[model samples]
Target: MSFLRSLSPLRAWRDLRRFLALRKPHEIGFMVISFAVTGTILFALYKDAAIPPTYKRDVLYVESWPLSRTDREIIDQQKADLIAEKKRAAELRARQLKRQAEFKRLDDRLERLGI
Candidate 1:
């Protein structure tokens, strides 16, 4: 069929050679510019039309308690959670401070060594 024949690399190469041999430089430049502009427009349109991805990363997972739990239990759980969060934050701050101190010491030693 015509479609299969058009798919031949040899035929396509010959056509390209023929076009280059026959066309003016300005004609080729215009064709190249036209193709580039048309391609960019089509790509933009395709991107806009395509469906976006749904991400589970946007959903924040939180702890769920039983509906049968009393108000006092809920309050206690909240307090415990807050305490745990604070402890974690404190630990992170301590780690960061320790790292900063170590880096400062290393910098001082390096400076003494003229490095």
Candidate 2:
């Protein structure tokens, strides 16, 4: 798109520089330290030498994204609870329909008696 093409890399860099210039010295130092730490962690994660050949990269990456064996167990338990809840809901719905039918029968009897 023409709009996307209009975005200049130099302009973005200049904007970023201006934004950084507005920050206090302590804030800038904190930002730099955080960036360094994050970059180091990412570099370590993706660097081929840091990974063992036996482990697939996808498995290694997925293992770190906040879900482990205990989490899986919890998820499975929740799914089971959900299924039980659905079954209970269906039972309640059937009871409700039966009650509604009984009420309609009573209403029809009252109409026939002119009450």
Candidate 3:
């Protein structure tokens, strides 16, 4: 136990000297900078990967409207009916304009006849 005690003090002193010798000023500075840079990069990556809890919302159940085959057929028929109605309206307007021009020509003829 006495021998062990003597060896431990010497070993501790040797270890201390070795540690002090290995830590040069430039090496210590480089280690400090490297650790700071690694810590910063890891922190940035962790923050980027983390999801914010404030944005989480509650889920809601939604009911959908059911469409049968007959309903789809009716919708298609209505679309066709609307297109036909639009075409009929356009034709009616064109005929009305033609009749108005004919009426204007008749009025001009009556004016020339002084009636």
* Candidate 1's TM-score: 0.41
lDDT of 3 by residue, 7-32 (tens): 77778999988996889899888977
lDDT agreement with native, every candidate: 0.88, 0.85, 0.84
Per-residue error (Å), model 2, residue 1:
2.6
Model 1, C-alpha of 21: deviation from truth (Å): 53
Candidate 3, run of 10 with poorest lDDT: 54-63
Candidate 1, residue 36: the lDDT equals: 100
TM-score to true structure, per model: 0.41, 0.40, 0.37
Model 2, span 1-115: residue lDDT tens = 9999989999999999999989999999999999999999888878957666542353323333335558778789789979988997898789889989999999999999999
CA RMSD for every model?
12.0, 25.2, 27.8
Looking at candidate 3, what is the lDDT of residue 66?
54
Best by lDDT: 1
Return the TM-score for candidate 3, rounded to 2 decimals: 0.37
